[model samples]
Target chain A: MIGWKQIPPGMVILEAGSALKIKTGSWRAAYKPRWIEENCIQCLLCWLYCPDNAVKVEDGKRQDFDYEYCKGCGLCALECPGKKGNKAIVMEEEVR
Target chain B: MVTPLNLKELSKKELRFTAGHRLCAGCAAPTVVKMILLAACDYPVVVASSTGCLEVSSCISTYTAWKVPWIHSAFENAAATLSGVESMYKALKKQGKIDKEIKFIAICGDGGTYDIGLQSLSGAMERWHDMLYVCYNNEAYMNTGIQRSGATPTYADTTTCPAGSVIPGKPQPRKDLTKIMAAHGIPYVAQAAPSHWPDLMKKVRKALEIPGPKFMNIFTPCNRGWRTRTDDAILLSRLAVDTCFWPLYEVEKGVVRVTYKPKEKKPIEEFLKLQGRFRHLFEPGREQLISELQRMIDENWERLLKEEEIFASKEEEKEEVVK
Candidate 1:
């Protein structure tokens, strides 16, 4: 019957500023998908629902993602409005 | 010499759900999946995941992190799929094809468990299948960008139920899932969270040992969906339990026993203020909603204590009869 108020020290207690210190560099490249020019129709679903505003469209056609801001959240890849065979954007691993 | 049971030692050495998977930072589903696997160990387990965050992140057709036998069915059929697996295992055991005891687990999000898959889950529970059902309840359909689910807390903001001029996010309270499972007279039903790792591990072990149906609703924090810091996953779970927003308890043999109760329960605002989902609750005229939420928690806590008292009295009566 451990008392609730006495949270043990070093028990991984989560504080407000804890997230600010975590290095998110590892998560950034985990799912940054590249668009294939051959298959892309540029429906812009990826751009519209970027969540992190990672995707950008040029002249309402060519789609590009700024990987620095992209947390690799995968919303763009999932919500692509392109037809099944003609997907405008496809998830490709970030090239080292 | 005192022998210590290193619970982590009971976990499988093989890494099934490897790191670098595509789940959102601080998503609760992965923790639930990991704990279930750790509890099951190498028991020839086969998992059926619903079409939610856990399924999409772990089994995206082209990329999969699962090392064991796993299947992804529709959003509302994980229970049915696991039931089929259990039936198959039983048939195979009868014919001597498989001699060892195997475990079948169904994993789903709150949407799948409380809303869409409720019928299938109820049917499986009614049939008394030898399967463990885990609901990674992050309170919404997180994979679809935070839509409201039946398990969503009252006044929590979601895409569909946004806090706006007229409405202050979700209007209804969270569905009582543990009571629902207990109503089916299941052998075991428990509510657990990752923040309480030891308690969670103990419940998982006990649930797995039971021969009949077992349901565990695990409160997992969704950093993106809940609008909280990515690192606050464990903290959010702790706050939920401490505020009595999510009581940690287990129901065994139709008797309810609260596993943990906080002393000087923290205010609901302490829990709500951290998450963006409940930000609207702080607005003017929203104090009523907060009070309503507090009243609900108080009522539920009282009911739980009353149930424990009744259970104790019943045990005493049985003891007198035996004497």
Candidate 2:
């Protein structure tokens, strides 16, 4: 949680590039993406189309979603190039 | 030099706009925001957003999705605010208070840019502020219950301009905003749709590299407002460009260039049929409206080609004289 007490009144800290602290994945109340690694062609289309920077990539390969920040918009599923019924990513309901 | 051909590299670059903000599913604004931020990867970015969907959705009181420094001021003063910020940065850099290079960006919706914020945007442009003003034009004022804005296309049904027996959606055509921006004679001006990522990405890079004011009017389709499926936003944008309704073009230093021309230009109906806003226009009585819209698109496309030719010749003449 951000500490408001440490900051001055009516003044924002304007912390440069500090979005990492905010966990946004909890905002996904319904659907979440389940990546099927084997089906992925490594096209990286899902990573490019994701509105949120939730798609985690390492060393030019698709790692997985940073679920801590993914809002489960399912854009990756929509942009997945895998064949029907065998999509590299699938949008499923959150277990909770 | 992040090209659309290598947008995958963008994922490696630190994203200025992160995920988990509250933009709607398949909303195009986030794509626009991300692409612009990635385009400015060469410098530290400071963003200013007007009061619109992108601002309201992303920045709540306690949280923000923006990884870069951001400010949300008013419905019409984003450009004005950023101009001030850019001037301050310039002063601070000269005074040795700040040493690193910083780029300024102002994001506004069509309502803010084409209507309410027009004067402020024009003022900033005329002042030649060193920043980029990007209008994510979703056509109507979707933030305020789909009100008809200056950027709304002709005969499209908005809440304020509802279709009826007597009068169809907006009676007037959309204001030619990109041309208006180019008339400012700034360093760069462009009209891009997210459908063509590479073209848009290239424009963003070129615009940011330039020294003076830059403007980009991007066609952002709204799923809720357009009454289309969430996943159809990109498809809709592609159709828009294919129909030549939103031609991909740019103006740099008074020279006009058409970026992409579809091999077989799709009909306006292909673009108009998908959006529920234009559903009424397909009815039997509204056939004339379709023709009218098509005619308007054709006229604009012709004008763009003519302008490109004229400008290219002018550039050649200048080179000849210099030689």
Candidate 3:
């Protein structure tokens, strides 16, 4: 851990988004979502509905899940309306 | 003209409310905060959050999820704090001490806004501060255990008011804080849900644009407090809108407009049954309570529609409304 001396002089938080250091992914007890790239229609509904900004997007397109912060809420899978009737995201037991 | 909300453009903007915070798995506050920041991403924003699940979770001792300037204040004074900040900004701007246009937003939970901070909020709006006050109304005081709040709808079971055989749940309906805020004669006031992002975001943009006090009563779901499925936060919000329990509408300059009217209004049961807080209302003996709740919702919806009709501007007919 960094010393308090390293902190900028302020009553507010030392860093704006220093919460990024906390990995909340371990909050998942049993299940996590497995993304199927081919079925993703990219409507971006999952990204919008995600409680965590786990559904990463790059340059306006969907990217891989950011597991560091994802709590495996599976909202992305629940909200994703993929191509045809197949879902772009499916819940899977976390082997790790 | 309502410029079409492009999801792509929104996605490209830098995230202000980031992840790794300790909000619950399916907590709706994070999504709500993200949407608010995304809508006002064009302007530099300073957020003041009250002592609730949002502030404590997002801003732990040494870490913060907010990229924008953020301050955490007492439970009953977020509005007061932000309004003071806005007043200072005005004073500074007059003295040529500050130049950049900065937006002031005070975020509060239902407990803070509806119950604890109501007077502070009312006073700030009355003072005509240039700021936007957003209350993430989860219906109860979820932060300090799920206790009944002034915003808790009738018949819902909270810790303080449990739904027992004799007592049932909370006997009285929620205080209509939206109408109360609208009565303040502020420039903008709206009620929105996270499920309808486009409508919600558009309201945020509009609220920020208008100079003066703006208040948005956003009905965000609290999965932990409501005992809902972790993934059902957005779904429940959508059902709330469709069932007319939490109608999406805005009061601009005292002229009311119902933003998204359900094509076919659904029964309140659809919205109630999903949450454990309202589970006791579904029992055999409590069936009458359901109908009573239904009637109450229908009455509320009618009243809102009537308000919209009465205060509707002369330019647009009552039937042809913005969807």
Cα RMSD to the true fold for all candidates:
16.6, 2.8, 3.0
Best by lDDT: 3
**DockQ score of the complex predicted as candidate 3:** 0.78
TM-score leader: 3
- The candidates' DockQ values read 0.02, 0.42, 0.78
Task: Quantify all predictions' global Cα lDDT against the true fold.
Answer: 0.74, 0.85, 0.89
> What is the lDDT, from 0 to 100, of the residue B212 in candidate 2?
90
Ranking by TM-score: 3, 2, 1
Candidate ranking under DockQ, highest first, comes to: 3, 2, 1
Candidate 3 displacement at residue B153 in angstroms: 0.9
Per residue, candidate 2 scores C-alpha lDDT tens digits across B1-323 of 33343756666787777665777767889988887887777778889999999988877655567888888789989999999999999999999999987888898999999999999999999999999899999998998789999999999899998999877999998899999999988889999998788788888888888899999999998988988876677788889999998999999988899999999999999999988999999888678889999999999999999999999898899999999
Each model's TM-score, in the order given?
Answer: 0.76, 0.91, 0.95
Ten residues in a row with the worst lDDT in model 3 chain B? B314-323
Considering TM-score, which of the candidate structures 1 and 3 is the better prediction for this target?
3
Displacement of the residue A53 alpha carbon in candidate 1, Å: 28
Q: Count the backbone clashes (under 3 Å) in each candidate.
A: 0, 2, 0
- Worst 10 contiguous positions by lDDT, candidate 2 chain A: A11-20
| Model 1 chain B worst lDDT window (10 residues) | B1-10
Candidate 1 has which clashing residue pairs, if any?
none
